[model samples]
Target chain A: MAEERQQGHKWTMIVDLDKCTGCQACVVACHAENNVPSPSEDEIIRGRANHWIRIERYWEGEYPNVKARFLPVFCQQCGNAPCEPVCPVYASYHSVEENLNVQVYNRCVGTRYCGNNCPYRVRIFNFWAPHFDPPLEQQLNPDVTVRGPGVMEKCTFCIQRIRRAREQANVEGRPLEDGEVQPACVQSCPTDALIFGDKWDENSRVAKMIPHERQFKLLEHLGTEPAVYYLKGGETHVGE
Target chain B: MRRLASLSLRQRLILGVAVVGAGALLVALLAIVIAQTSAADEQPLAFSHKTHAQNGIQCQFCHTGVAKGPVAGIPSVEKCMGCHTYIATDSPEIQKLQGYWERQEPIPWKRVNIQPSYVYFNHSSHVAAGVSCGSCHGAVAEMTVAKPVVEMNMGFCLDCHAEQENKDALWDCTVCHR
Candidate 1:
């Protein structure tokens, strides 16, 4: 089905690494949008944490020349998703129409096999039930469910937003226009680092960015065909 | 279980039967209590759908957000009083409505029917598709208290969705249960 849509829209995300300021606005926006739950400080220390999108910080250079680099890691929505087939219950799979990785939360039996199989390591296991500190519960977006414990959850490319957009578009009897359905990360990126659009549309920003000589997938050598693309950093050093 | 090893075979069989019988009885009683509590029969006012429908009132007139938002919003106290202030000043129901209006306090209506958290049923989408209030809701025009006429389970949803005309965009698990 993705191949059939070769001339049609293929949902893809392009992240311009050069544009990322490491502000982690995208990460915070994702948590706010997706009800991904906040584990307590002790749980975070125990290596139990929940962030659908996490900014991986790396320090480069030495002796005052050191600079922290940020790479926001989320579900790549791989074309050949390694996390799909290994799912004993088919909870995580690719959507033919969306051309994006889809997770059926209710179907997930929490086998954690998908977590083990994901090459991106973006998949996370909900070790315990999610708890909200009083008023924080009011801030939750009702469109997304507060996933219960014992279910493996991860970035769905903010599929709830996509679903709403698509449904609205259908009701209006029109094909999705360019820049219509933005995943939470893309929408909240203050630096314009994340651009989500149909890659098949030649005029779309993602299509234009995908061909840049510096563009690369996280684990291209693994042949996972990650839907997320990254633009190589500029020659200038960050935090200078 | 290990302590029961010392008991005779006959005695062990009897214990197993007794434990199973008690468990079944407990389960049955729990089901009844759950059913009774969740019937959606009681409301702050004796709001009768039959009377409203007979008086030519549309469901959307009260539940204003049914076609625009996720929730089919309950009518506000002010919305109720807007008509009742002049129309039914002598009626007991109107008096109750006026009491709330005078106090400016919202009624705490008990929740009636709702899908599990997993099922993300959007009211706008269904309403826009021209599905009637009486579709999943049954013959609501004939009912007084809005008790659930259908179980409204996955099977119930699937049965209607399985029809050819209403089949599109309905099958996927992500379609409903996000």
Candidate 2:
């Protein structure tokens, strides 16, 4: 039981929104790393674009007191994931080893039940075979698959790269270093706003960030126990 | 004999034609294989690697990003003129390099060693681990047309990695998979 519990390490991320300049580096990095297809303009207008990590814009109040907030959202990989229970084919389930919500593309029949159940609307469906134009396709990271049509897809937290890093560490007979493994989003963030690590590790950065007063999860009222948390933005700047 | 003679002449002709077509197809397939093997020997350019390497140009100069990224990129024509602009302006090969640069079209260098898209090999990691370029590329500095001498099969990669001297870099499926 102890070994099983140890194996089920919860991986989490805390994005400090205050530090985020809305540069979209994380968005581009995620796309490059995971091979997320860029949808046509028509599809984007219909909100069918597949962005694994998106910077959501929120507006509050009127002209004099107008305040804009940006939040980077992605697959929360919830402990009690709502998407998991709704998956009729068991395509979406939490992995026993990493506590990651693994989405098996081969198994997904595109029923989209999981997408509907997700309150955050992070899951993206491939209406067409995702393709990149010639030279652009060459730039794709071979680690991840380019999903075909009729399959539901979402973030896997770059599990393929993680698996690679872990295997390398094992070969060397040493524990994984702190910054040895970084997802594309975390790696590309210019301001270091996104911090990813093993949440189960008491000394991990994620574990330390989660307890801060400014940290909170989206739709936490539903008891989803999301692995992702956001640090609230700093005080608004006004004409002095 | 009377019953055999009752068979339609057209039906007998059709059977004879089908057998002849099958025979012709088999012969054509063998010829194609022989042609391909012979065609593989043709070289488009007879560039020498030994002379360039001897001039103190590192392998990474022509194969840019080999030490920093996933791809060991074929250097653009502009990169060639960085030194050749002053060193060998009169040479025919240098003139060819300059002409391609003026046109802004890259040289379509033939890939002697190509891996399938599924395999994720990072030159940076391998180079950092002290694996020489010759280990997989087969003494590129000695070749003229960069012919692939080593067959980069899974077994070959495993065997090299399993060497006691290279035990630290030994086989991991994810190393190449991801």
List the global CA lDDT of all models: 0.82, 0.77
Docking level for model 2: incorrect
Q: How close is candidate 1 to the true structure, as a TM-score?
A: 0.88
Kindly report, for each predicted structure in the order presented, the TM-score of its chain A compared with the true chain A. Answer: 0.93, 0.92
lDDT of 1 at A81: 88
Cα-lDDT of candidate 2: 0.77
Tell me the tens digit of each residue's lDDT in model 2 across B27-143: 999999876545534544345788899888889878887766667887677777787789778888778777877888787666667675545677766776778998898887876
Best by DockQ: 1
Candidate 2, residues A1-240: lDDT per residue as tens digits?
A: 122345535678888888888889989888888888777799999989899988888887899999777898899988889899989888786676667787877568999999999988999998888888777788987677677788888877778867667646654567766666688999999989899888777777787666877878999999888888888885842111
> What docking grade applies to model 1?
acceptable
Tens-digit lDDT track for model 1 on B1-178?
Answer: 6889999999999999999999999999999998867757768888888998999999999999888766889899988888888987899987988888899889877777868887888788778788888888888889888878788999998887778463644765667765
Q: Residue B105 in candidate 1 has what lDDT? A: 89
**Alpha carbon deviation, residue B91, candidate 1 (Å):** 2.3
The parts of candidate 1 lying over 4 Å away from their true place are A1-3, A6-9, A236-240, B1-32, B35-38, B164-168
User: TM-score of model 2 relative to the true fold?
Assistant: 0.59
